[model samples]
Target: MSQHTPPSPVKKGKELILDITTAAFEGKGLGKVGEYAVFVKNTAPGDRVRVRINRKRKNYAEGVLLELLEPSPIRISPKCRHAGTCGGCTWQHIPYEKELVYKSGHVKDHFQRIGGFRDISTEPVIGAPEPFYYRNKMEYTFGDRRWLTDEEVQSGRDIADRDFALGLHVPGRYDRILNLEECHLQDPVSFRILDAVREYALANNIPPYNTHRHEGFLRNLIIRNAEHTGDLMVNLVTSGENDEIMQPFSSWLLERFPEITTVIHTINDTRSPSSEGRYQKVLYGPGYIREYLGPYHFRIDPNTFFQTNTHQARALYDVVLGALDKVPVLYDLYCGVGTLSVYLSGMATRVVGVEVHAGAVEKARENAAENGVSHAVFEQGDMKDIFNDDMIRRHGSPDIIVTDPPRAGMHESVIRQIISILPKKIIYVSCNSSTQARDVALLSEYYRLERIQPVDMFPRTYHIESVAVLSRNDT
Candidate 1:
């Protein structure tokens, strides 16, 4: 028998008016057109918008918001002037309360739909105390091509020098950059430095790096601020080392803002656009700055991976710490720089940290040593390879396992290993809920899902950090 399928209600390049009924994940708005779902960006619930369908699929379609016919009642003015254009903070226009609601709902929906869990215990989301200027780190790219906004084009103003931009990449366009006037994510001093750097580059006639040509004087600028310790670091990534340009620039910058604790110049001779360089030279101060999570202090290098949100990270770690009871031994999987491992060392007699990056492993060892944490040891290798019986025999079996894998989530082999070992409790901390739910589903038979605590680590964005507690089934 041949079955007939109906055609889609919307077509590409067609314009239609829709009343947004609800909010969806990734800062999208959902609306229906005769039983067909359409997704639009930069829209909120209770809004009527004119959308141009750009992508059409079998059941749903994606559109671009062309005009906002009616604004949502709950809509709030965004703090940043670059609100809708900048991709860093997508939900800035929506109220912070509504943003929290959407994030919590998304986590719950992922568990029910992806994990196939009919009934799940979920706690209320913990919102950040200070939503703006909470980021400890900010990365700005140097591009030769500048992206112009629609407003700028319509104004008919004489826009000069469309090249040499020092800001974030335009959404979905890697080669184009939007010259950022102001950003509310990092400290105000960081933006002041950014503007000063841009002025210096322009005055010195420094050309930005071209993605297509791969040749320029400026590459990227990275700033890291220690919230608790008040230490600041500035990392300048360039195509090559030029003492002629760097020496005077560093002196001028330091003279203007003496609060800069350290300055590093990194050289990236490769063609890749990554900010990480081949090697770095310390232009001023020590090569590293110190940060404090709680009572413990950590040395942060230019390339080290630390939590971006310094304030909210304490809240996120509190969730992980609250889920645990004292145990003889604990295993911290994917433990980068041993932050959580060292943090949780107080509750366990011995903690074994496993990470893939050797450099991170070395830093973890250093951090543990710096904090006088003698009971914690870090092993460098892939989780799937190192988490076998041999390693278990070397450093006694774990009573508890805490796994925090990347966005792709844990590998199936790691899941199988956890199931085989069958620890008493598993604390899974994840940044992506969909992948976390899938991993949880894999261990459904051996472990029972207890509850999940969602933390707003990065506010103004769709990203979330959650800690899922699972206990081994007694039966």
Candidate 2:
């Protein structure tokens, strides 16, 4: 196949009768359009469809569903009404069991094909206990326009181009909203609370924030609920215009929904592309939300980073701990708020957590103090700087290293430092499997890939979180 192909006219506005060839680009179904391959959403291998080309790239094309000429046997009707538009669950149309199988293969494929580590043995992907309602965290955007069909728009209903937030933003379009009635990915409480909040906003004449003009009363809403503990945190992203809008909103939420233990507001004045909660204001309850994982209780703020799936997150934490075994001195790199550090402190004689964010480090210290954990220590600095010999002498060379880096994966320098340290065992937890595999390949010289297990942190989405255990190979 040619690496580059000229744009050719697909039938019916670049809509081609294409058959899915294989999985490509984050495990989406791939088909050919002229010489270039087309990535189709909610498609599987052997599926034939007439797809509408959206964006034409040099080597591939992005397409949408026009008509399923011959649907794959694996295709099933998605449960959610907003499945295609919500952007939360792209693989809802694909069977749940099949999705797990495909994800496991996807990780293996990324290592073999992309990372050049063909011999890496991958175990069967571990699935979530409950696929639906597994997500403990959800951040929903507010838009001023409710997306309606052309037929409905023509019926003289004064709806289109009006100031109103439908619900969450559609995949690409920022101006439009998908109007999610209920998301199956989140718990039933989330659905009810979202609906209630939307209704309350509409009733109170609180306008949805316009991303384009940066005007409006409300911008975003985040809901975090713990699975083990029935604790909830609601963070409202607002325009920072008035305290009036929040008084009633917060009052009503606290009174009506007693489960909401932490209700807060964040003033997002900057027109940045970040969805994070900023300049927080406590409306009700405490400054943080609480959750129980095993013997530990975690208090997380709106900006606090907690694993998405609470149940599976515990499992993941256990995997990391098991991989580490019982190292005398351990290091937790990229440790956000030191969740893992606090949990494994008792197991190890001493635990040192290295994080880049100062705020996270403060929170980690607070958590350690609150938990009465004295063996663990948290240092706020770039891991590259903190992993030096001097620091190693002070904290002792980490017998085992447990790092959970960001999606871009660990820095090459950090990886080199890890290899230099030569920890007895390295538990690499990654949200992006491709990057994880790539890093593992780089460390293949010194470390042996003991096991790679894919954990479905975010179900129904293409993203896969994997825990790869690496041990030093004695030649």
Candidate 3:
């Protein structure tokens, strides 16, 4: 959008070798070619690489890494061979220390540029204790067409032999999956489970679902593990009913991996797993597992939203809870499972959690009663609808409010509603800082940015989770 900048250096499909000066937003490498900015994927701050111009825009260009001529001083050899191909762990090559630096930069840039705020303090990113194997849940896709390496293509290997793959989706290619030899993000037992499932599906001739044709037996394989309890839940998502095929396989998994405490068969009749995946039968053990956040225990259903990394999540919650000073009445917007409100119920006279999902509200009530939290209340309704002035006057004003919205951030109407019923403090937790910054900008009219703590929930990746405390400007 800057008029003084020069045109892009290369046209679409052109190739160039450039020196990457810094990391950009979205985990890409930033470089300039004669005042023309270029963003190349799979690169580091000091990397010098050859790139192919994948897309040409008016102000900037997008590129794909073709060759790495020189590695960054901070770059380390990626532990996993499928680092770039798997589309997970985009920052695995960068040193963990440098990764923290870049993550801090991301928060600062988003606030300064997007929110137009210059004085917010962005503390150093809170690093994960164990960077690798930190993720508690991983979903492996089942594709009939497995992605082949360049060497395999060149070697004239039989295409039929490479037909089936139960691994990660190829970046931007949904029809193919890169069969994982090993993955570092989850427990190695997860990789063992992947191998076992793949082997069983192949031996039984259970066809992998084709996203294009929308016909197959196996669609997706989701695995979740309780980090502290070492309890595992394996959910085999299928397109149609094949109890005979899945029943035996689920039993085999429970027998083979004693660590696997639960196995659920999710019969998904719909095309996409996200739209229709539900727990049809608990083949082994309980259908859900309990994850502990401090003394509070949460019954985590396989399909529900729980923090993927529990260790860093605790740190984030502690930061938010520590910021709240006065709470006679508290309102938690976008309160999934009412975890935050439940965690702070004892401190407040009454804690009201507002969520749109009815099932989640039901579960939150169950969780609250299970934890002996009598002061917390959950209301299932749209935030915009429930956060009105009449409702505020009836329920009484809240001393403090906390919201952790989706990546889209709080809607403008919801933000305005919050401004109307201004609380003493607003604790905003978000995964997408870009949208968070925009929303914070709107609230800046009545609230002052007090503190920002960036927590790395997902390590070895570009994603960041931030908890921001905004004080009432009047207060």
- The candidate scoring highest on lDDT is 1
Tell me the tens digit of each residue's lDDT in model 1 across 1-475.
Answer: 9997877779999999999998888889999999999999889999999999999988899999999999999888889888889698989888998898899999999999999997885798999988899999999999889988888889999887688799998889999998999999999999999999999999999888887997898999999999988899999999998999999989989998999999999999889888988999999999888999898899999999999998788888888899899999999999999999998899899999999999999999999999999999999999999999888898888889999999999999898888888999999999999999999999989889999999999999988888899999982
Off by over 4 Å in 3: 1-8, 155-160, 275-279
Candidate 3, 132-214: lDDT as tens digits: 99888999988888999766689886766477888898888878899888999988899999999998888889888888888
TM-score of each: 0.98, 0.92, 0.96
The reply for model 1, stretches above 4 Å from the true place, is 1-3
Better of 1 and 2 by lDDT: 1
| Residue 258 of model 2, lDDT score | 86
- Model 2 stretches astray by more than 4 angstroms: 1-13, 25-27, 33-36, 149-162, 273-278
For model 1 the local lDDT of residue 368 reads 97
> What is candidate 1's CA lDDT for residue 40?
93
Model 3 worst lDDT window (10 residues): 271-280
| lDDT, candidates in the order shown | 0.92, 0.82, 0.87
Higher TM-score: candidate 1 or 3? 1
